[model samples]
Target: MTQAEGGLRARKKRETRAALAEAALRLALEKGPDNVTVEEIAEAADVSVRTFFNYFPHKEHAILGRNPEHIERALDRMREAPAEESPLTTMRFIVHDVLRDLEGEGELSRRGELIMASPHLLYQLMLSSFEDERQLTEALAERMGEPATSVRPALIVSASGAACRVAMERHKADPDRPIRELVDEGFQLLAEGIDPGFRVVPTKGHP
Candidate 1:
């Protein structure tokens, strides 16, 4: 195919994939996931069942649409990071970049809502998160010139992942508040040694 034609074809495929995912998420939200079917999702997206299958293995995957390509791209960025950058700075930049890229049209917030609404999706998200964490640790260790088994990379990944989780939870709780701001606050907390001082209030019945 000509370059122009190839570009058009790629755009079309992306649109189709997005349509299928949007349809699946919408239908799942309207009628519980258990009540939604692949055929219904295909019809909603105006694509054949075969086309849906070509993009995703099943309905739940379609609804979640957690793109493996996105993680690959993040790993690529990590691998190509500047030699002089510290591991923490590299991670902060990479995390913010991924968040901004994925937050298009508030899609991340919508996905957060869907995940919270469905137990199966939540479980899938947890699985995906673990995998992402594994890949990130490996890439980070390479960046740090250390082995994948190094405790330094693992600790950095665990701490940053915790920051991101808190940010996501805050976004889910108050979606109107910008997710980027929440994430920035999370990183700020980390920068401050995660020791923002506040005395704990004693419960009424227990001192």
Candidate 2:
């Protein structure tokens, strides 16, 4: 009931969630996602199966290490952007803030590789991303003083998601390249407006 007690409880919960996710990723790496089970993950993390369910709805989420709080934090940051800033500018800030933390985390690259190797995990990740985009659309609409059903908000959020996805794919291909640079370039292209039919021209007789 005391503030200290509540804080301790929250911290413990986070520790449990993180332990479960780490165990899940380890098991997934050794046995693949299809071979890992909730019971095994819980046992590995020293938690009960019920506790694992409390942290993650399914094993894929644990393997992906998807944190719902990150989405909420990004939404909060986007909503706080200056009213004078354009939506794209606000989005750029949000994307950078959310992903910058991953720069030094080597585990993220490993997780990305694991996800890419499994078709089912990739599908689950895509579904989770779509849900995050939907939440972001709603938040953006609120900040823009528009209805959630408005076309512009949906368009902006969807476009931003697509750009981020492309950047991530490129990062996966070349881990040496800084992901932040790719993400920035993707947002820059969005800000500059890409020509729908734009194509590269061949030099000399190269065509």
Candidate 3:
């Protein structure tokens, strides 16, 4: 095939893969995740179930999606971040690069809300997290050129994850809020410092 024709073919494949993922997420939202089956998603996307399996190993894989290359790209950006930059700064730069294109995350965010609302979907997403965490940690370690068990990567990933989780919570509560602004708010909150007062309380009867 000519280079132009090959490029077009690759683009078409990407489009088809994206359509299948969108179909699966949509069905999961409309009828809850558990109700959506692989065959149903394939049919919705105008593809055979075999085609769906070619793109995704399972129904859950469609929901979680996969882009190891993208993660690697993000890590590459992180690696080149200023030497003196803190983890938060570096991670924000990396994550913003990944998320700024929108990457259809708004749709994913909506689907996430639906997933959270249903116990079944929540369970499914939870299962996906185990691998998600492993891969993320591995990426961080690779970027830092440190061992996976090192405290530096661990601390940085933890803080970054907390920021992301906070932003997602706010988005779920009020999606009208710009996600970037919400994420900024989380980082600001962390900057201002968190304090919890502690006191010993006496039993009312004893007092």
Candidate 4:
């Protein structure tokens, strides 16, 4: 096939995938996600159930519309980060880059409401997040010239993940508040090291 043909096919697939996701979200909003089915979503998007499955493994995935591209870009950024940059700082920039486009209203607000209202969807998203964290952890470890199982890589990943979670929760609580601003605050707290005035005792096994 010609380059033009390949490009067109890729675009068409993206369009179909997006249509299915939009249909899934809209249906979930109108009739809870548990009530929506693959057939219904496909019909709404003018696609076949087989096509929907090709795009998403299940209905919940369709509703979540998790974009692979965003995570891929994030992983690339971490891998290419300068050697001198701290892992936390690298993560801050990566998060900002991934979420910057989502700063405004419209789809962002609708997704917040959808996920917050549905426990099932939230669980699915959580699972996806774990996978994303794992991939990012490996990339960060490679950049640090350390094993992925090392405590340092895991620590950075966990801490950065907490910051992202807090920012997300705050955004859900108030859609009017810019998500980027909240994310910045979370990263800033991480940068400062969450140290309370009082000293804390280390666990028996850990220093």
Query: What is the model-wide C-alpha lDDT for candidate 3?
Result: 0.70
Candidates' lDDT values, in order? 0.82, 0.85, 0.70, 0.83
lDDT winner, 2 or 4: 2
- Ranking of candidates on lDDT, top first: 2, 4, 1, 3
Shift of residue 101 alpha carbon in model 4, Å: 4.6
Query: Model 3 compared with the native: what TM-score?
Result: 0.76
Candidate 4 runs further than 4 Å off: 101-106, 196-207
lDDT of 4 by residue, 1-207 (tens): 999999999899877877888898899889988999999999999988988888899999989887787799999999889889889999988888766644431366677678878888889988998999999999988899898788888778878877876777898888777777887888888778777565778989999
lDDT of 2 by residue, 1-207 (tens): 999999999899877877888899999999989999999999999999998999999999999887777798888888788889999888888777667544433466778788888999989999998999898899899999999899998888888877877777888888887777887888888878777678889999798
Question: What overall lDDT, based on C-alpha atoms, would model 2 receive against the true structure?
Answer: 0.85
Q: Which ten residues in a row have the lowest lDDT in candidate 3?
A: 189-198
Indicate the TM-score of model 1: 0.83
Which whole-number lDDT from 0 to 100 does residue 41 have in model 4? Answer: 99
Off by over 4 Å in 2: 101-106, 196-207
Q: Give TM-scores for every candidate, taking all chains together and pairing residue i with residue i.
A: 0.83, 0.87, 0.76, 0.88
Error of 3 at 185 (Å): 2.1
Q: Rank all candidate structures by their TM-score, best first, as comma-separated numbers.
A: 4, 2, 1, 3
Error in Å for residue 34 of model 2: 1.3
Q: Model 3: residues >4 Å from true position, as ranges? A: 1-6, 101-106, 142-146, 191-207
Candidate 3 lDDT, 63-113, residue by residue in tens: 655444456676676667777876667777766665664455446476557
lDDT of 1: 0.82
